[model samples]
Target: MEQTWRWFGEQDPIPLDHVKQTGATGVVTALHHLPAGQVWQPEEIAKRKHVIEEAGLSWSVCESIPTEDSIKRGDANARRAIDTWKDSLANLGRAGVPVVCYNFMPILDWTRTDLMFRLPTTGYALRFDMIDFVAYDVFMLKRNRASQSYDPLLVEKAEQRIAGKSEEQKKLLETNIIAGLPGGASAQTRSSISSLIESFQGIDDETMRGNLFAFLKEIVPVAEEFNVRLAIHPDDPPFPLFGLPRVLSTASDIRRLLAAYESPANGITLCTGSYGSRPDNDLVAITREFAHRVNFAHLRNTTVEPDGSFYEAEHLEGDTDMVTVIELLLREEEEAGRQGRRPRIPMRPDHGHLLAGDIDRQTNPGYSYNGRLKGLAELRGVIRALTRGI
Candidate 1:
């Protein structure tokens, strides 16, 4: 495994010099300043690459190049959006960046209802409370047909929960759900989000799946031409939200994706936290099955509640079997090496708890320096122990 860190370029509070200290030789990032559906000019890509290289680190993976909503909805602008995405992909591949991780989730991307859920240790972790989310959908954003998506009992509980909150608390809840997290899509206001949800009114799971496949068909060939591996990130929370369709939440969903566009360039980003949010997803099995097609990995864990809510857990402490998952990845790497292929898979510690000195500083929601440093150190220990027979 090639250890990497996610660095939100230039504007990030954590400096590149600090990243070098974390023992990660690679960086996973994107051109966040550029708006969605815009072409990534070659010069901009070179500039970002130069900065990462100057810091004694390599840009191992382009975390994402923003799959625009136009493409997701298969709207009138989708053709232009797909062409721009291909242009960006070619530019990245020209720069020698190996892996490109992206997602096909419509509207929102990797949402959470609580960004600062305090853990028992007094540190904060990202959380998704099902009741709180349902409350937000039904009472706050007021998406049409939102109440119908959730269980009747859960909807009743959400109504009760919303009735008890003050205005300030309600606003914060809305912000957490739609204000967008670090590296996510642009923040959405109540009115804007409602309209976005309305735009997808007729797009169901099957429709959304078709749109994703159509988008892939156009871009995967470009990726293959440029020698870039396209890895579709699993849907965060691994379920539907805001009455939107979810097509990348389970093993069956992934099987369909890989089969739709058969090629090494058409792959998956094995994010343990995203898939592990659902108990039905067997992480070890998924890893073993897709090991050859995994272009990147986000190694994090989550402790899930019975009600479809979950909180970020220590990298090795959650429901996921970290040791076994890593063991399978290493075995896959060994086999790839035997076949004269690139053996190192770029992986980063996905998210970490806000702890110690990081408790007071203003940092990106789940991306504080001290927190991720601790996670990387723990993961490094595991990788070393597994490989050296220690």
Candidate 2:
């Protein structure tokens, strides 16, 4: 495993030099300024690569080239969106970036009601309280069929959750949900979210998945043509949200995704945090099973509540068996080398606790400098120990 850091272009509060100092030799980033459904020029790709190299880091993975909503919903503009996606893949391959990471979640990329869920030992961590999200979805956004989306008990819990929140706290929740993350990824508001979820009226999980396969049918060949690996990231929280279907969630979903194109270029970004959010997902088994098709990895862990609420835990402290996961990946890399398919899988610490001086500074919620630095160091040590043994 090659250690990589996700840097959000030049304007990121954390500088490139800071990344280099973190001992990450590779960078995972994207043309964040570009709109979702646009073609990425080869020149732009080269420029970003050059910028990364100039900072003493190689560009390892394209963190994302956004999968436009049009493609996911299989709308009229899907063909154009997919064409643009292929263009970007080609451009990336030409520029020598090996992996492209993306997701197919609707409306929001990743949702969290609490960005600063505090732990006594670790300071603040990102949290997704089901009750908070349901409260927002039902009472605030008031999406069609929102109540039906939850069980009676859960709906009551959400009602109780929101009923207690003060007006200021409620506003904060809305802002956090809709303010988006860094790199110009916009968020969905009450009005826009409802309108967007409406687009998927007739689309169910299987239908949406079929649409995903249809997308791969066109783009997978382009990826193979350019010797690029298209790594689809799993859905964050790995479940349905706001009555919309989430296709990329579990090992079963992973099997389906890989089976779609049956090509090496078609792959998965094995994100432990995202998949591990669900208690059913065995992180070690999933990583081992999809080792051959894994193009990139996002290594982080979370502690979950029985009712599906979760908060980011330290790299080594959460429910996920971090040592086993890393060991499996190291063995997978070694096994790949034994065959003719040796590949340096790029991985980054997915998200981290916002701790120390990072709390005082302006920071992206899950992307604080200090928090991820701590995570990367912990993961790097584990990787080093495993590789040295190997």
Candidate 3:
């Protein structure tokens, strides 16, 4: 495993020098300034890569080459997007970046109702409470047929949660949920959000799945030609949000996708935090099953609450079996070595809570330093223990 840290280029509060000091040799980043659907120019890639190299780190993974909305919607612009995506891959290859992480979810990258949910011991952490999310969908965002997304008991809980809110709290929660406060991007206005939610009206789960496959079919070959591995990130909650259908939220989704394309370039960015959100996802088994296809990874853990809420836990203390998962990854690396494959998978401590003195400040949700440094420390110890025993 190649330890990496995500840096948001020049604007990142945590500089590349700080990342290098963390014992990570790779930087996972993207052209955050580029709008979606645009090609990443070669000059931009080279400039970023040069910065990373100058900092004694390699730009190991492009954290994403965002899938265009046209591709997600399967609209007339899909073909153009397929071409543009190929061009981006070529640009990355030209810049010597080999692995790219991306996701195919329709509306949002990831959603959480609470960006600062206080943990029992840790000061505050990112969280997704099912009731809170449903409350936002049913009462706040008011998505169509949002009522149908939850069961009766969940609906009851959601209503209670909504009712419990004060007017100001209600406004804040609505802003937090739909305003995309933590998108690490600008917040969308109420009208824009409404229009965005309305856009998913007819795009059901199956339709989204079809679009994803169409997308893979279109670009996987180009990725293979460029010696780039395109790893699709799993949905953050491993489920739908706001009545939107999430296709890459399960193990079966990855299995079907790999079988569909059967290309070495078609890969998975296996995130323990994302898949571990679902209790049924047996983290170790999924890791072993998809071992051959995972070219990138995000190792973090979460503790799930009964109400479908979950908070970031100490990397090794959450719902994921961190020990077993890492052991499997090491075993997979051994196997890959036997098969003559280089096993340098780029991974980072996915989301770390705000702990220590970070509680008072507003950091990018989940990208805080203190907690993630703690997580990386723990994970490093775990990896060392596993390797020593092995």
Query: For residues 1-390, what per-residue lDDT tens digits would candidate 1 score against the true structure?
Result: 999999999999888999999999999999988877689999999999999999999999998998888888889998898999999999999999989999988877778888889988898999999999999999888877788888999999999999999999998888888755333335556777778788888899999899999988898998988889888999887898888889999999999999998998898999999999999999999998889889899999999999999999999999999999988888888788889776488999998999988888879889988889988999999999888862
Model 1: residue 175 alpha-carbon error in angstroms: 0.5
Question: For model 3, how does the per-residue alpha-carbon lDDT over 69-184 read when each residue is reduced to its tens digit?
Answer: 77888888889998988899889987789899988876677777778787788478887778877887888777678799789899888899899999888776765665333243
User: Candidate 2: what lDDT?
Assistant: 0.86
Clashes of 3: 0
Clashing pairs in 1: none
Residue 280 of model 2 has an lDDT of 93
Off by over 4 Å in 1: 181-187
Number of clashing pairs per prediction, in order: 0, 0, 0
Evaluation by TM-score, superior candidate among 1 and 2: 1
lDDT tens readout by residue for model 2, 127-243: 888988899989998887889989889999999989999999998897777654222225445666678778889889998899999988998888888888888988887988888
With candidate 2 superimposed using the best TM-score fit, by how many Å does residue 189's alpha carbon deviate from the native? 3.3
Off by over 4 Å in 2: 180-188
User: What range of 10 consecutive residues in model 2 has the weakest lDDT sum?
Assistant: 179-188
What is the Å distance of residue 263 in model 2 from its true position? Answer: 1.4
Order of quality (lDDT):
1, 2, 3
lDDT, residue 90, candidate 3: 86
Query: Which clashing pairs does model 3 show?
Result: none
